[model samples]
Target: MRKNSIKNIRINSEVQKELSNIIRTEVKDPRIHPMTSVVAVEVAPDLKSCKAYISVLGNEKAAEDTLEGLKNAVGYIRRALARSVNLRNTPEITFILDQSIEYGVHMTRLIDDVVGKEEVSDDGMNTEGDEGSC
Candidate 1:
């Protein structure tokens, strides 16, 4: 089969949805934060394993706890996915913390800071009114 075939894409999406729901409603671990979200999922072509990207809205400790909770509940999640999706072999779910959103925010803040400094310097250097006087 070709890489990332239609069938594989559909399977990945279904698994992502099912796993998100399972994590939200079924898992009762206290370590799992309520603000956790499934960012993305990538299923192998062979359908034997999957990587689930998760985003947690909190500090590093909270992210660690959330990941630990998901790791502990992997079995239950896989079972639920198997039942919800029609597949011969349920892919093994591996939860990975996604920090791209946080990184983007940081980058934006840095850009804004630079722009603010530039604007302040420009304001100080404005001699337009006295340009033709001298």
Candidate 2:
């Protein structure tokens, strides 16, 4: 058996890409997480399993509900994928809701807050820049 390289990843990745397109264009469910973006796809070397990373753009009850909706529609999506992809076996798809986007937003807000505070202090509010501070 030859070792699988990045090229070997193309087939499964194509499947994932196809699935993304279909979901965006075909899946006509209002609850299918409109803000959801397919972040990445990782297929096992055997091509029997894949974990899809997805990010939802907002933080609210709707976001949570959207993820739940995506979970429920996995089967239909997979079935649709099988129709278009010419493969011996269509890998099982698993959706993992990525919170990295949310984390990034939170981090950005925190940084902005810090910068805002610094600006206020620089206006002679807490300018105790003595030998004790950096």
Candidate 3:
């Protein structure tokens, strides 16, 4: 099967959803932050391997701990995945730390800071003009 085939896309979404549910409800590791989420899932076309992108809303230590927790629980996770989803072969999951969400948030804050500064300068100039006119 092609990488981007309709079947592959469907499988990816299904696996992503199931993995999210499993992590949210089944996993009971303190290291796994409560704000952990599965960002994306890519199951190989051959169904032999999978990459699961995970995003954790916490400090770097929390994220690293979450990854470690997930790695240690990979066996149970795979078994859970196998039971939840029917497939020819249960793919080996590779947990990947995805920082795209955090990056987007940081970029937004920078843009907002720049905009705020511009607004302040604009207001100061306007106030000076108003004082002169008065």
What do the candidate models score in CA lDDT, each in turn? 0.89, 0.77, 0.98
Give lDDT tens digits, candidate 3, residues 1-115. Answer: 9999999999999999999999999999999999999999999999999999999999999999999999999999999999999999999999999999999999999999999
lDDT of 3: 0.98
Candidate 3, clashing residue pairs?
A: none
Which prediction has the highest lDDT against the true structure? 3
> Residue 62 error for model 3, in Å?
0.4
On lDDT, the stronger of 1 and 2 is 1
Better of 2 and 3 by TM-score: 3
The runs of at least 3 residues in candidate 2 whose Cα sits more than 4 Å from the true structure, single-residue gaps closed, are 1-4, 125-134
Q: Which runs of model 3 end up more than 4 angstroms from their true locations?
A: none
lDDT of 1 by residue, 1-134 (tens): 44489988887788888888988998899999999899899998888889999999899999999999999989988888888889988888899999998898889999999999999888776776467577
Q: What is the clash count of model 3? A: 0
Name the weakest run of 10 consecutive residues (lDDT summed) in model 2.
1-10
Cα displacement (Å) at residue 71, model 2: 2.1
TM-score of each: 0.88, 0.78, 0.96
- Measured over all alpha carbons after superposition, the RMSD of each candidate to the real structure, in angstroms, is 2.0, 4.3, 1.0
How good is model 3 by TM-score? Answer: 0.96
